[model samples]
Target chain A: MKIGLFIPCYIDAFYPKTGIATLELLEKLGQEVEYPMDQTCCGQPMANSGCNRDAKETEALFIRNFSKYDVIVSPSGSCVHHIRDNFDAIEQTDEVRHVRKNTYELVEFIHDVLKVREFPWAEFPHKVGMHNSCATLRALRTASMSELGEPFFSKPKTLLSAVKGISFAAPKRPDECCGFGGTYSVTEEAVSARMGLDKVTDHHDAGAEYIVSADTSCMMHQQGCAERNGVPIRFIHIAEILNGARS
Target chain B: MSNKPVPHAKLAAEFLKDEPHRHFHDERLWDMRQKRDEQMHIMPEWQELREQASRLKEHTLAHLPQYLEQFEENARRNGIHVHWARDGAEHNRIVEKILRDHGHSSIIKSKSMITDECEMREYLEPKGISVTETDLGERIQQLDNQLPSHVVVPAVQKLTSDVAKTFAKYYNTDPNIDDPHALAEAQRNAARPVLLSGDTGMTGGNFLVAETGSFVVCTNEGNADLSANLPNLHIATLGIERLVPRMADLGVFIRLLSRSALGSPITQYTTHFRKPKKGGEMHVILVDNGRSERLGMDDFWTSLKCIRCGACMNTCPVYRRSGGQSYGSVYSGPIGAIIDPTFNAKKFSTLPFASTMNGSCTNVCPVKIDIHDQLYKWRRVLAERHEIPFVKREIMKMAGRLLAQPTMYRLAISGTEVALKTMPRFVLYNYLNPWGKHRELPHPVKETFHSWYKKNRLNKAKQHEETQA
Candidate 1:
């Protein structure tokens, strides 16, 4: 019943509403929650760039702040994936084991743990297309990606369908990357921008008024590209929509 | 312009400028990727085959030395000449020597990326040896004096009209014949005489069977068969990692290779050459060329298991848009991102950063190379060696510092919105900020979530404590 909220650095700094929405949604589902303010990030940017030494400091810090909670939840599947799957540099003590074992992304937590089919408080009246972040879809296994022959299911979509006045837009390459890719958006700027434009353009062509995703890092990247290129579409974090941001 | 040695980011940026061409290039490769998915779906055991192929490759790599020796001994007994090349220079020298010893002036080639990697044509052509690339795509690229943009479909980036012009220039055909079939026919007709008269033939093998001392070369066009069969002197080049333990094991790779390569049920010609024709010499050269050194790199050893099918390239969003030429390496796309960095960090350091680390390359790989994971690991290795671009490296270091201390991060970023709103776009979107060049920065939130949570949740907790007391 008690949960610790893990706000990834991007959500905390770039999009505070997402963190607030995550908190509100968890509370509305009748769970006791605590926000560990000392928790800054999951050390993915460092670890992914091959800077193990840099990642170790944050890795140890993450375990220190979130080790006590029976279950830790984050709005970003990628950050949770970084903590659970890629914290090899940190010593594998009991606390590290507990932190890695219990962390969950928001959709998976709601769909699998909360197991609540009804969301009486949630309402969104827009045609939205889902952008499956690589970390969330492929890394966290939050959904069945189009690549595999596995029976198709999406933890995020299941919850979205339960929300009132929401319709889904199905794009041609629905599962392709938005290409934010953390530092890649800047480092490989042109390809990254082209990828983001392609993804946002696809959703817009599919008639989505807004593109929604589980990872705000992707949302930020796609939204930025959409706005700059004058693409007539908006991006919303799944948490914001689930929290009834429109209201 | 020769795309002068530049970072992949810059090269990709320039490549994306031809917006219409880039979109055409993107859709052309994506269609292949979609077709590959169709093939993958038909086979219910596609995932199982990938696992089996990956495990087989891993076992072969782990026991590679023993397998190589067994292959050499068995190949020699089968009357196939075996050559060991320590590097690209050696591989090229050996190929030249074979042509010289056999008195061959013209050589015909079947789609061998290894030869491209060794720059064999560049080495051989200047010395009066005519090297003809028989694969239609490579031949088109060869005539145009261009490198292949995609390995499997070497000229896939080109349109039918582009090939029509290239054919007209080289073969004296009508440039007006823009139909795909007409252009292909012209190229094929021009190739027939060259295919028959060439005194030497060369190919890149898909798999080497150490058990039977046989090698398999799969191609849909049957060009490998023509080049391989017509010449009295035949040469097959392969990376040392191409060896498989047994001939029977070819089943798993064959099942995955064509389906993953072009989504074909099977290649038109899957030729197994255990022995050459009477009085003809068939030489199989095993080229190391940094592959042996890569096997020692624990973080990247699995990368050597690549089958050169180009499946990863087809599926890579970055590669599809940027084109393989942007990679500035023979290997491009996700596989190139991993393999290039392992060989020369200073030269290929930017390659690993080219990917978004989406892991789609990992899923589609028939050999299960775990390509995206390797890209991540390569980035870390580059930073350890201080090979990351200087400014980016320092920025990452600073980020690590700020991220470890939440209060400082909160203080620094919470009020970032005011700067975004007031700051001129030119100042923020200049050359210094790569993200700002073609994309806008995300508008910042009013305050950090920590500040909001403290005021809202922490205050409520305190009020509840007072009420309970």
Candidate 2:
């Protein structure tokens, strides 16, 4: 299958390790992957701020670049969510429709599509608390969220537990948003920062050494807030954890 | 109303100065949401209940004119006077005229948010008609001369000590008393005299039952029933959208209402008022107050489906952290974020942007109002109207251009890297930097993913394809 790697702009710029891990892990699973250099973003930042006119060009650029791939995958949920749910302006051609339907965030592709039960090369000896980034939790329907009380299971937690030597401590409020919220982190920084701080405090209280999530956008916001407030916790991407290889 | 409006972002930051209090406030409401989830688990058909309630609300709103007219006709037939007010001022005037006609010296109210929307206390109190709020939370806020920050838990943000002090100062209850039950009983005793002796009683309707021409009001405190039962004149202020087509529909709403609002299976007082007491008057005033105009704007028309159960506010993370007062609207939280912009864009413009668009409010909504989506829509509408900050418009324009073209995006990254590497903290974390005020920027890496991909991954994959060909 032809797989396209769609790198969200912030991930491409700030956390290249997540994109690299995504690339390496997919190849380890023996899937053909292509990195489209021209693909920058899903036009979320502009469209979310109500700049539809401004997002149009990026939207067009995205369509022109990655429309041919049988499957397009990104390490971020928020970007994919914007394309599937909020692309109201795009002409709904077969190609545009195909991209929307075929595109998946990395974890959903792994949990729902790959359905892997074991990771022969992965090992993470750490107490990890998972952050259910809001876009991924609610928008992508990746798992039965803690908010909706069912026999509870998580897609990220399922996959992460496959790795050897990793323990999971679910936060007190497992599904409460980390509050990175794209531009909201900066626009409503006070509430946004407080939310991040509280979230980290939950994980810390649960005795997590590191916090991991699928969307680096959230990791970026919370990680920055943790560092600023001296919260004594670290953040990482799910891709990096899944790509973990032991000697 | 005329001064410069401080946007939600700035006000939220100001509120966060007291971070310890903010965390405590969040946990208290979050516990209610957690309890709501516990209640949902006991009933296996929780999602189904939500869907049926949503559909019923949608059906009622779609055929609102018919249900409303039927409700009015049925209400009048049952010896209940039905009055329609086009707006808030009109609604207040109608209530005042009712007071005038009856020669009522005082009125007792039981948690009517519509009256707050009408600014009724300010209107009636100055006119020599004293209005005492009967709901305990409302009574506290009334004594404090403050708007109820939350709709369901009017004083949800207030600490127990604050209520104890209020009770102590106002009613001469134990000033040092801190036990919740003791303080509550003291206030309840104080409110009993005022409520029983009042000439008129006013309350808000939760649902207007079209089939029976009766209205439903739910409360845990039993204040509405007490006020409605004791007074010679009982008035209900209902927004036109508060209608259920059939009495049978009550089961779905009754199950979902308090569970969503307070995490309880049902409110203590889910009283249905179909008619007046013997030799007394029952009046139901139907207030539109821009709700009809909202029905015309199809994009936002679904907002009328709100049940005002306050579940959206309870589950809202932003509202949890920012508190209700920061919203600067009669209604606060996610619902206000959407509804405020619809009513007055220029004044409440920041409310729409207050959300992180995390979309939790949409999940918890009993009527499934699509609140976060509406908030997004409101932002676009305001941006189109040029109601957002000029800096945001300018930055979005530049970022849009940079993101559209890969080369420009890359070039801008270079400059951003340079700025991140070199700029002083004064510039990055200064008053002008909204994000920088509270959050430190994640420093950009030297080599971007595109650079790494181009150097190693892209060409190798292309060469493999070439060999395949």
Candidate 3:
């Protein structure tokens, strides 16, 4: 399968290793991948800030960058969700519409499309908790599907559970946003920090050594909180773990 | 009085300073939500019911004018005099006129956010008509002569001791009373004399069904029932958007509403009054109060779909921690953030930017109003009107300019990382960095992914293209 890699601006700038892990994991699964260099952003930063007018140029840039690929995939659920949900409104060009239809988040892409039943490598022996990002769980309707279907094929937790030696513990409230919304962290800084602290506390209280999630943005925020508090709990992106990277 | 509007952030900061025993409240509410969701999930039809309720609300909103007319006609036929008010002042005047006509000096009111928004108490108290708020939470805030911090849970910010102090000051009760239930009973006892002597009882309607010429008011404490039923004259104020097409539609809303708001299967009392019982007078006031104008505007019409369950408030992270008072509106939390700006645009314009649009409110809404989306839309509208703070506008504009260009974005990211890493932590923790107050900035990674990807992936791709050629 030819997969077009969509590097979200945040991933491109801050955490390139997540992108590398995604690419390596996909390749190891015997999937062909193409990285579009010109793909700067999914226009989320602008669109989410209520600046869709400013996003127009970036939207066109997005369409131009990855229109031809059959399956466009991104490591971050939030970025993929932004494109799938909001791209149509950013001038519904045929290419943009096609990209929206074809795009998938990494976990959904791997589990749904590839049907990978198990991880290629053994996972580290530690208790892990999964924090669902808001965009992925709510916007993509991943939570609904997880509730309905089989363990392997349906839920993200089930998919994460397949990693050998990794025991997944449920959160006090499943699927709550960690409140690290783009620009929200800055604009409503105090509230965002409190929310992040609460989420980290939940994971810490769960006896989980590591908190895993699909979106690095949320992980980064939570990780910042953990580091600042000098808590030993570690944050890992699901893609990094799925790709068999151990901390 | 301070000229400046109540500083919600400062008030919240003060409240959090002590870190009062809010854990029990949070834990209890969270537990209730979990149980509610479990019950809701037991019935596979819950999602369908939500959809049905959403559609019903949409239909009602689409033909609001006709349904409202029908409601008015039915209400009049049932011996309930119907009045229309264009705005808050007119609504208050018409309400006061009714009181004046009856020669009533005092009236008992249940928790009506609409009335509060209209400054009804402020207006009526001056007219020598004592409006006693009957809801336990509202009554507590009333005793303190403070605006309700929350729409549903009026005194959500107040600890039991706060209520005890307010009760002790106002009703000369024991300040030592720390038990919530005891304090509530004391509040009820204080309100009892006022309720009995009051000539008219006023309550807010959750919905007005045009088909039955009836309105429904839901409450857990039965305050609305007591307020409306006990008095000789009962007055109900309903926003124009509150109308539904038929009585049956209430079933769907009632099921979704309580579940969403307080996480109950249903509120204790869901009273529907078609008309006055026996000989008692019933008056229905259909208040436009800027709603009809809001419905005309496409971007905001969806806000009218709200059932005012306050579910959004419960789940909102910003609201949960900061409390409703932080929003500085009669309506607080997510729904309030949207509704307040619509009613008083200039005064509450900063509300939309007060929190992150986490989209949890949208997810948990019983009526399924895309609240976070509307919040984003409101931000756009506010920005267009230059309602956003000047600093925010400048920052956004600069971000827009930088983010528009890939090179600039890449350069800016690298530059920021370099600057942050080299600079001392306190240097970056200045007032300008609002995040610095509570959150420590994450250390910048030495190498950004863009550079790594360019070196390892993009370069390889170019070399492969050359090799293929």
DockQ for each candidate? 0.74, 0.74, 0.47
Winner on TM-score between 1 and 3 is 1
Model 1 per-residue lDDT tens digits across residues B145-190: 8777777888877778888888888889898888988887887898
Estimate the TM-score for candidate 2: 0.95
The residue pairs that clash in candidate 3, if any, are none
Q: Which RMSD values do the candidates have, in order?
A: 2.3, 2.4, 3.0
Query: Predicted candidate 1: what Cα RMSD to the true structure?
Result: 2.3
Tens-digit lDDT track of model 3 for B1-469: 1224345555555555555634544554556456556656676787787778888888888988788889888888878889998888998999999988989877888998888878888888887888888999888888787788777788877788877888888878898887988887887888788888889999999999898788899998888898998888999998888888887777888888887777678889988888887878898888888888888888778889988877777777777777766777788888888888777676677677666666877767778888888888887787777676677667666766666677777777888778777997778988887767776666667676667777777788799999999
- Per residue, candidate 2 scores C-alpha lDDT tens digits across B312-364 of 89898999998877887678999988887766788888888888898889988
Predictions in order: lDDT: 0.86, 0.86, 0.78
For candidate 3, write residues A120-203 as lDDT tens digits: 584767788887788877677565522222123235776777887888666676556676888877766766776788888888
lDDT of 2 at B457: 72
lDDT of 2 by residue, A1-247 (tens): 8999998888888888888999999999889998877777788998889877788888888988899899999999999899889876567789889998999999989889888767778899989989888888889988676656767778888998899999988678888888888888777888888898889989999999899989898988888788888888888898898999331
